[model samples]
Target: MLTLKGKSVFAGITIGPLALFHRNTISTASHTVENPEVEVIRFQKARDESIEQLKGLYDKAVQKVGEEQAAVFEVHQMMLEDDDYVDSVEEKIRNGKINAEAAVDQTAQELADMFRHMEDAYMQARAADVLDISRRVEQQLCGGAGIDFSKYDHVIIAADDLAPSETLQLDTDRILGFVTSSGSTNSHTAILARTLGIAAVVNTGNQLHNDVDGLMAIIDGLTGMVYIDPDEDTLSQMRIKQQEEKACKARLEQVRHVPTVTRDGRVIKLFANIGNPGNLPQVLANDAEGIGLFRSEFLYLENSDYPTEEQQFEAYKKTLEVLEGKTAVIRTLDIGADKQVDYFDLAPEVNPAMGMRAIRICLTRPDLFKTQLRALCRASAFGKLAIMFPMIISVAEVRKAKKILEEVQIELDEKAIAYDKDMEVGIMVETPASAVMSDELAKEVDFFSIGSNDLTQYTLAIDRQQTALDAFFDSHHPAVLRLIQQTIENGHKAGIWVGICGELGADLTLTETFLRMGVDELSVSPPAVLPLREKIRSLDLNKA
Candidate 1:
């Protein structure tokens, strides 16, 4: 028996025989072509073929995943047809007089290398894209057929790494799970697998050999552990685990459209916490009542610089449009600390978590804050939109934020821009001070959202992002619970509703606790909504 540890991208248990993934490598020699124009034409023909291939891939991917995920193939198509990419290869063939294959490989390497050497991790990850498109063209030039994996079934995939295209093209019904030797939880393959609700273990450091293609294996995606040829006892335990997982999933589906009312008849609203509109499909698929938290900073993070008001407006508008009358509570410009935008050129802070961030940055830079506020307000008329401010510590800060929002409203009114004049506004009660003073602060806002992640961090005085702090960080600490209880009570006292929007909201163990405490809403990740609803339906909060 052999065991390997990796990182988990999704949580599930699967037992299956291994089916290895293999890519065909093409090698070419630099031949001096007689006519440079003929070499260019050859490249063009191959490029056209690759473009058609990607178009087919895009269509199929859209059917399997949603448009957001299928966009990966669309991006691959654009890369193939990029004039700069084509011109670069043509320049090599026309001037250097190299054959089409050699020129294509050389040109792809140059562009891929540039991205690989970037300081930003997000840009560096894009290097794989350049190489992926190049591989398609190179395969055509070498007269090789592309990847095909339709023959495999009832197996766990053993891959060096799966590109998004490969993951989308495979028959997922037959594929039980994935074991990749090179990938992170942040990789596109991992993201797609999680979105598709598949079990995946990544970065296992190559345990399976090519000859061991049919080895019996058990994968525990929750623990990031894989067992090959395991002992009888291990197999028995894994079988039980798999059965329990199946049972749990079946129960969750039963409550897919059911209201989150406890056995005691207490009602709890379940919402989704999404960073952007890309997660809306899951939000709808899981039957969430509304969007509890939309971290709008994502628009800025993905851009090289600050996003324009129109750009932010379109993103916010589209997200609300999909809600179809369900509320979308958007938090404005919560950028700082771990999630920083490069264009901001922010200097390293000794204690960034406790320093200028979220509402502080928005308050200091009214221009940046107002730009996002105007976008959010302008988009309000299109659908149900609620604006929330983060990192609140005082009633004065809440008043000040409202003042800026009023200024944006005035500017929009002067331009005759339509918006929800009576839109709901809220504040995140993440700090101890905010919780203690929530009675006063709640009077200034429409509602309160307790950001449990940050509330835990501040109350426990632990840097939640630090690996070493994992041992000390406790989300369920008495202090954190007391603050949450106090904030909810205060919001109610001030005649407003309160919700919990953080990792703790998804915690099944806390479902009864929050329900008994009268938490009006629980907003967690999309995948947790159905399960939470199941828990809610099973609980007797009155007895608790």
Candidate 2:
């Protein structure tokens, strides 16, 4: 029983034969070439071919995932055609008298290293894109056919790292799970894995071996374990687990259109956390009751400048329109630390995760905050809309944020722009301080939506994104649960609804416990909605 552990990006169980996915990296040993022009032609031909490949992959990915994600392929194609990339490769080939393959490899590494050195997390992620597209080009030059995934259905794939393009090109139906020795939970590969609903254990730190290829394996993404050639008893137990998973999924499908009400007639709202308007299709498909956390950070991440009110309003209004009459809690600008814009030009921090961010940025820059508030207020008239402030730790922060929101309302009213006058305002109870002082903060806000991801990180002093500390980052720790329960009680006492829109909310193990604790809502990723509802509907909370 050779067991490997990793960080789980998506939760599920899969028992399958192991398949090793290896990308053929072209060696860059400089071999003298006869004709430099011929080498340039080879590089250009390969580049064009890679672009065509991306276009085809984009079309297929659109069907498999969604438009926003599929657009990444287009971005890859553009990067390939970029002068920076093309000129660098051409210069290496012509000036250095190197072969096309060697020049491409050298240039790619240079650009990739540059991106990796960037302070911005988004730019750092782009480094993966550079390496990914370069690999595709290198594959084109080497005449290497991509991994034929069609041949290996129902297999757990182990790889050093999978580029987003490689993942999108895969026959996902054949892929039961993924175990990558190198990958962050925040990578595009992780996003695709979650979108495709595949169990993945990433950042295993190169512990996976080629010898394990074709060996039967159990990928327990929930626990982030990879079991290779388990004992008979363990295999038997895993098989039973696999059966239960399928049965649970089947049971969840029956309640697709049903309300998330406990057996004892307790009602709970189940909402989906969406990044942008493009996610609406999944939002409706998953039958999520509403959008609990409409992450507004994408506006800042996707743009090069501080987003204007008109730009922000269009995005907000589109989201509200899609939710139809359902509610959408738009968290205002959770930027800085992990999510930063170069335009913002925020200073470096010794500890960014706990530094100036989210509501902190908004409070200091009321100009930026008021713009988003005006947009949200205007969009509210289109559908049920709520404004949520992130990283709140006190009643003063909530009151201050609400004061700015009120100012925006007054400005809009004077300008004769129509909006929902009764739009609900809320604050994220993510910090230990906020959870502890929920009684006081609850009196200031219309509702309390606990951002358990940050709450867990803050309470346990764990960086939620750090794969190294996965073992210590316990979301279910009694300390965090006690805070959740207390916040719920406090919200109820103050006549405000309470919900959790974080990774912990999707945990089915705690669904019954949350219902028993009187949580009014469980907001999770769209994929988790139905399964969570199944758990909610099956629970006899009264009995518990």
Give one digit per residue, the lDDT tens place, for model 2 in 1-544. Answer: 8888888978888888888886555676788887899999999999999899989999999988978678788888888988988999999898888899899888888988887776565677677888888888888998957876576678888888889977776677778888988777767888788778888999887656678889998888778988889999999988898788788778878999987888889889999998877678778988999999999988888675778889998998888777779999888899887876778888989889999899999999998888889888888889999989999988888889888888988888799999998888899999999999999998898999999989999999999879899888788999999999999999999999999999999988888788888899889989889988888888886583
TM-score of 1: 0.86
User: Where's the lowest-lDDT run of ten residues in candidate 2?
Assistant: 116-125
Candidate 2: residue pairs that collide: none
- Candidate 1: tens digits of C-alpha lDDT, residues 300-340: 86675789999999999999889999999998888886676
Taking every candidate in turn, the Cα RMSD to the unseen true structure, in Å, is 3.7, 3.7
CA lDDT of each prediction against the hidden true structure: 0.86, 0.86
The deviation in Å at residue 172 for candidate 1 is 1.8
lDDT of 1 at 211: 73
